[model samples]
Target: MAKIDKSLYSKEEWLVIRNRRRLEKQLKKQKEQISYPVKRKSSKVAFVLGNGVSRAFVEPEVLSKLGVVYGCNALYRTFAPDYLIAVDVKMILEISKSGYQNTNTVWSNHNKAYSNIKNINYFQPSKGWSSGPTALWLAAEHGYDDIYILGFDYKGLDDHSKFNNLYADTKNYKKSNEGATFYGNWLRQTKTVIRDNKKINFTRVIAPDNYQPIELNNFENYNTIHVGDFQKIFDIS
Candidate 1:
């Protein structure tokens, strides 16, 4: 690349140009860093794990044995799934500080801000989506015919008033007493994945009282099952 003639442009104009160039370079590096596993013809089942409280009683070890597992965010603190997806800067930093990224397959949007983290993989053409939906999308992209969504309660507990994550009150998370995080984005993103991947089957495992968004029911590819039945089917005692 030729040297930029900084003196030829106004300070503000130069700043914009510099930032654009920097982003382009970062995107290039991110593209190069992407590493995907070999797609197995026989690999048809996948599990996409979220941090919702409904799945608190479930063990990731049991699911890992059934298929490829992709977990989101703080799920890494407990069990390292086959692929861990975290987009939030704080959580990414926490994972990096623990040196988890050094030996694990973690994916995140490529940002110049995280240039210091050397081991994790960057998603090419970054989705800019939240971790749970991103994990779902990744699983769909891997050609899984059947994908089970675990812990995606999609709303708060206690009539949607309280925080409902398995990792609430822990590091990099809100206190259990805090109000629920908005679910609009998660619902829309999840619906988009289902719409885009019509061929893949998505079964959301929900507790009896789990909030069900009406929008999801419109998708033919999407379905839901009570957590009790899920446990019985999987023999997850």
Candidate 2:
């Protein structure tokens, strides 16, 4: 378990470091061929849920908008999203016991403890990816044209109290800012993906000010809406 000083690296700088570490790890492991899941249907828009301040504003009806929902980490605890992604062992254990059988869960190899869990898609970590980045990659690979991400605020990196995920109180998770640096890595990695894929437009809905818009069309125009506003805007009721 190596660590990077969060104080020393900007989010972008940390991305460089994280990518290097991933390459080194892959080289050491000889790059196992991974069987990626089949590309999902090409939905016009998809939602990627993150645990952030705005997470409290989302309702189950907003997630039930026919648009595919890709939730990361503890999101499944609150809503049965269409897709769930996790790289943490504790989260995997929690989801396994939750008995919510609708979503397709994807877990990285960070914790191999849940490999025997049937129907859960296990992803081979290629170059040190986190849950959020892996989920974005899956959406992009699946040919989704538009992706709206929610609750992915990097505010906790500066203000620890903003780490208010629903599952923070759960066992094995710190009730405070347990992994701010890691969250920053996810942000940086997601930024890289958004920049690399010009065809796929990535939109961060209800994101905090710290998250800048990527170089995608209509990104600047995408308004950050509250739950009520989102419901009204999308006619979710």
Candidate 3:
């Protein structure tokens, strides 16, 4: 924990901080530490990313069959998800105000403003991770046998635009052509995490041909499958 600047924060502010810490500590104790390769019940889960391609390619019917849909960033604006996640401080704070709905929301432990929000889960990641990959890790921890990722286009800059995400306009998120810098780093870290946990099967659902498969060391864990196959795998109409 970083040393708090005592001069900057008043007693009330300090009290809130201490209370939040206490709450987070309690939450951590109750968190389930899911062991890998323990069981395989044929559960199918989908993690929907903010890339524009997901909006274009993945259909609602296919998403409905994926057992659960974990929406990233501003996905709530476009589609309803069983779980909504945000690790970015700004996005968490923003969504906490408006989209606090029936869906289960998981937020970073660093953002204490989300404390009062109902149906919210707090997670303290072992390392600094971006929202998408972190969501993958969390899903694996929850024991989903098969995980599908949709709209995870790694293209940070197209030939024409700086915007990388589909919901940037609605969420007021900044667009950068240099998406490869930050987004690329996140992908590498996420791939490492996926490689470490090989028990869970991960499929990139109907991604473009340009988005190459994330290779694992000493194993083949990741693959690309069509959205139609996603429906068949889960037996969803």
Candidate 4:
């Protein structure tokens, strides 16, 4: 067995642990505060974004007006949405651990812009195998009325056919993604989640030209939503 790092248990680590415990306590105190019926209903259209969303929709006002669930990268320096939700902490940790300090720097800078934002949420999978899909599925399972995934590209920025092209490294901090194959597992789970849940009114659309054929069929709800259509649907204009 490897020796434990005594330095890891230093003052900074203790302080973070203390804060987390305190936060949990405070949250438990709010159990009563959550008993009230939810006033604000989930939007008819909710958006999920990843890096793929960057260039796809130039005029995304329709999506912008509805609820937006931003990915980790989207939660960056000096840019953010009115509301946001994040998953894929595993990926973030990898990037953060690359000796680049990218995660902390980006979050710190972007948090300033999001200070006035109303709701910021985060969720994780039950386990590693279930992370991304579960996060999206849970959003709809709980109370989100409609979900529109904007930039959840699940591929590299330059790749034409594949999505999430950079997430496959099960090896190192800066490992190859085996070409974003992880998302295939996520998409498969997502399809079943959609099929099993009928009460939920959700539609998922990938960006223009990014749709993978046979795989897209797995999702029964992959309808084409145009820019104008999104505006009319969400009344963003």
TM-score of 2: 0.66
Q: Which scores higher on TM-score, 1 or 3?
A: 1
**Per-prediction TM-score:** 0.83, 0.66, 0.67, 0.49
Q: Which residue runs does candidate 4 get wrong by more than 4 Å?
A: 1-42, 54-64, 68-132, 154-182, 213-222, 235-237
Which residue pairs show collisions in model 2? none
lDDT of each: 0.88, 0.64, 0.62, 0.46
Q: Model 2 residue 57 lDDT?
A: 66
Clashes of each: 0, 0, 0, 9
In model 3, residue pairs whose N, Cα or C atoms come closer than 3 Å (at least 3 residues apart or on different chains), thus clashing, are: none
Top candidate on TM-score is 1
The candidate that wins on lDDT is 1
- Tens-digit lDDT string for candidate 2 (108-176): 554458767766765554446777777777776666677777776655544543455555656756665
Worst 10 residues of 4 by lDDT: 102-111
| Model 4 lDDT at residue 18 | 70
Task: Write one digit per residue (lDDT tens) for candidate 4, span 126-198.
Answer: 2233444554554555455566655555554446333342222333223342334446676677676667666
User: What is the Å distance of residue 2 in model 4 from its true position?
Assistant: 51
* TM-score winner, 3 or 4: 3
